[model samples]
Target: MFGIGTYPRGGRLFVAALAVACCGFGNTGTADADTFIPLPGGIITRELADGTTITIRIDEESAKVSPSLGSTPVHRNVWVSGVGSVDLAGPSADTATIKISPGYVVGCQMDISSLGVNENAGESNTLSQTAPYITPSLSESFGGGITLAPGQAVARLMLDLEKPDDYGMESHKRYNKVPGPHASVTWVDEAFEVNGCGGYAQARSFVLAEIDTTTFIGNLALWGQPFTMG
Candidate 1:
């Protein structure tokens, strides 16, 4: 349940967070104001257990908030990509094991590409399929966007969980404040696995992202929520 609308006000959020941490531009940046927010990308398809066809696609999630020296505002870093594919609708070809249930990637090295998949690449979100979720479902990859259909595409994964951490809002005593791109890539459990036929199958899907810190600092914003299970 995520399909709101409003991410283009005039000039794509008005970048000002010290040029998004340009390289060293942050001695407490923030001259006056110009919040920048833009988030929208989603898609999730499911049908695994032998007749594989599990597709998940997230184009680009976003976030930016600059101006930090003490007041509170500096969570710049954004660039996310997704594309999970599997289609063995019976008859022949098989062998599938897509895994990326991993939390968040803030730098690099979360890549996977398969032209003729025989995969085992970058595996580590640790969730091993356990099927059993026809009701207690929940979706919120920020809260909107998912459309991927056409034989269910194939493998592709990219990450840029930008890093800036240190957004002082102090909700209470946790301090995480949704920093570090947070983390939420679900498949209920197992995320992926399909080898020969059947006997044990369970691989649903779900994603949730956040980064819209706008209370008054530089205006930065980006809410490309994501969530889906089928």
Candidate 2:
């Protein structure tokens, strides 16, 4: 599993930890299916379902590592998830049905972008309509949106984690931890549609990961015997 593991001090596991992390990407400049592209700490080199090749890597100088919030250590490992993904097929809704690609997405952070064909951020086109349906089980309140009115004009979903300092906060001990690892959001074979004019628009899905596990568990490391200096 690409799942992150903990570091061990002065043991074989310590060497092993570094070994896995050194897998070093971009050798072939691609990844097989279901592979994780580490965020600022890791990189993704692959083509999306749309055949657009992208690379995701955090510059060593820009990587931020700190003790994660709500951790016992409270002094180290503030590192978090990496961010990047392929642009699974997008659809433009037109009073019928909409489609999202590369089914069964799982991640802590996802980007959903929907807007008026002629509009930029915070601005809507005349008579454009989009009603985004987020999985009720997940929090859809991560981003700001205009309140729903009778046949509202537009809906937009955005998740931009490329900026490490701007990463979203997920309370470690609050929810989705232990005996279970669940995504903050999941879009499995979903379709959307618009009800008004302005021509329904395209949707893109990107993924981001957290370095800390959602679980409160660790492996038992065996130190055997303490080394003595002669």
Candidate 3:
């Protein structure tokens, strides 16, 4: 399957919902494979797995990549599990924030809730806010926001639909079928502080929302409904 889906002003609508579900899975290339490519100002086109392709040119300068249709125009060094096809060749760009370190995925149906972390904007206010894996120093870094120090680094979280849904709070409700469909992931923090360098880092991030199944319970994965929409 696939993962990483959540939107509400977090990088190109979560990379256009992972580029409209990126062709519904085919290249199960595995080996840390993750995909999302939607470029043209609100930039986002990442394929990270060592092939090299980056253009998260969010604020400006230095953003390049190759091979979407190919004709010889390779532009390397974008590092970190690199994968390509994202452009923002200037002209007052809009968005382009990229980073795929430890992992990435959004979903392609295993009955939705493909992966998760925290925050649908509820659950005691998402565990009392303030915890995006810490990272933000030098007087709160300010440009593209991320200033790593206290160990691990991996940030790409989006998903918060209004509030009052539960799970991770607010949106994670899907159910369909038998013997399968119930996924989860959570690791908000074992320790905090980024800029001042604290220690113990573990902030899991994955939320491919869309699981309603009449509110709660367990085992869910139903499809082809003549009626039902939550």
Candidate 4:
């Protein structure tokens, strides 16, 4: 469920609030129960070099965690949904373009909180915080299940753009671009599976944006609250 669209100013991206649910599953449970976790999405505002103000928001985030159909201690399954949006205001607002890339960081017995950018950091500092955890260059296809060991982590992008290159060969991109003063990307029920982690595991969502004002270029990112995958 990937879509790019224009959202009107001051409009809400998601109409309804998610109800929190309580359910648990593990290696021994019925394997049919699902736990729903509602996440507190985040927002960031940055003033670019040329006095262009860019705001990035991650909203309507939630995840459904379930025992792996494999019914093994090392397998886990999850369905995630969220919306990523960007709004530009200031000198170059009318002619700006935005590229939105939404993804997740999954860790096996590792603390992923530190891998995210500092929300309080300045524009230059935030742009410099491109650790592999935040900007993963992995070649693996995200929808395909991933395998991880303890103390290891991986980043999986939710958007995969397939297009033809200049040579007519197939190419893929992790981000979606749209002309904008305001643009958004929505994803629903995107599923990913994890395997080979016998210990505790966790996942967090993030939205990264590259903004081109036709004069100034900048980057913005927002991170969601991390949740356990049982």
Candidate 5:
């Protein structure tokens, strides 16, 4: 993975900027500080096994990091937003279904910079590779907040769509599904909290997309730059 406006076939790119806010209540250092990171989202173009071309783009993504309202060393807060888009070309493009899953990977005292679209970040075991492609697990959830210890990491999805199931029971989904040659999912100012980490913490954004067409099914992922939580 790379950073910011870089497109290297199957690689990733991200760019970030940080702004520090003035402290209040006589607090010093990074305590009570707020940081705004502007991220340059990425784009990926891939050709499926049946000669279908798919493009996925992560755009208008950013995060605002600040001290948690608890004001404790073990608590952190962030607000994130992004847009995930998909476009398809070639055969079966008109009848394809796209599923978009946008989420964040939070690590406690561990460097998650090496986590790529093809590798599972120590959280799930369902990631499998099919020659030049990977199938990502889509069973992540956002259960209020995250708690992590040193050397531990978690993947929290940003969306939870509540709808009626086949039997009229409530069903929750972590991804948005759409049809055809183009689709998009947009999230704005979604806030999440992390706690129980006594060391430095970091988080990165990702968009996992699955394209199901008449001829073949494929998966694509785009990643953002990692930013500090404290």
Candidate 6:
């Protein structure tokens, strides 16, 4: 999934994010002695040394977040797209429990461009392509930077998802991006199956969302984490 915007361009830009899942991602929103913990798995509990239990969501499969942790785990039953959920704190103390369910497979969305590009009428530069990766894959360089001129622009944005090989090596590329500049365009790739050969495929999805910028004067920001499948 990607969201695009335009502004004066100068330097190259890129953005990335990991899939959101089990106690996946969270922020305290403050710097005081607090931790921003994400609970996406629908049911999560942090046991204190003194036996005080802190319970919360597992975060990967749902978007419905409570303002704060509730007392009854059942009340935290939030809704999610594509994933069936489990009950909270059901009668077990030592049994680490998990259940299987059906859900959509989300891929990585890279938006590395931000604030449009500003060309110097006669100057041309190449827009570089970021590398693609498989699960636990590293980033790469694919598209060369685009050349630009004053008052003229190019859509240097592209999102690619390649399926891994039979042995789990990636072998396909699914790229989505508007070829040119438009006001604001959002391209969301449909959910696809993950490379299942990896042991963690049933529980994790690696995602990267980046901002591509010509100049680094301003900041490009991305919110949210990877979509959890467990």
lDDT (Cα, tens digit) per residue for candidate 2, span 1-230: 01221111110111000001122212121112222222223334433233322222222211122222443221221111322221111121111111111111111112212211111211111111111222222222222222222223222232222222235643221111111111222222122221211221111222222112122111110000110000
Q: Would you estimate the TM-scores of all the predictions?
A: 0.23, 0.19, 0.19, 0.78, 0.75, 0.24
The candidate maximizing TM-score is 4
Model 2, 191: alpha-carbon shift in Å? 3.4
lDDT of 6 by residue, 1-230 (tens): 44434322112222111122222343212211212223233433333232422232223332322211433211111222222222212222122221111222222222211211221211122221332122212233223222222222222223444666689986644332221111132333212222212111111212222222232111111122332221
Candidates 2 and 6: which is better by lDDT? Answer: 6
Runs with alpha carbons beyond 4 Å of true place in candidate 4: 7-32, 117-141
Residues 14-106 of candidate 3 have per-residue lDDT tens digits of: 111122122122221111111222212123333323222223211111112222132222111111111211222222122323222112221
Q: Report the Cα lDDT for residue 110, model 4.
A: 74
Among the numbered candidates, top lDDT falls to 4
What does candidate 1's lDDT look like per residue over 75-121, in tens digits? Answer: 12222333222111231112222222212211111111111111221
Q: Which stretches of candidate 5 lie over 4 Å from their true place?
A: 1-32, 49-51, 118-141
lDDT of each: 0.21, 0.20, 0.21, 0.66, 0.62, 0.25
**lDDT for 11 (candidate 2):** 9
Which consecutive 10 residues in model 2 have the weakest lDDT in total? Answer: 11-20
lDDT of 5 at 37: 76
Q: Provide the clashing-pair count of each candidate structure.
A: 23, 10, 22, 0, 3, 65
Candidate 2 error regions (>4 Å): 1-187, 213-230
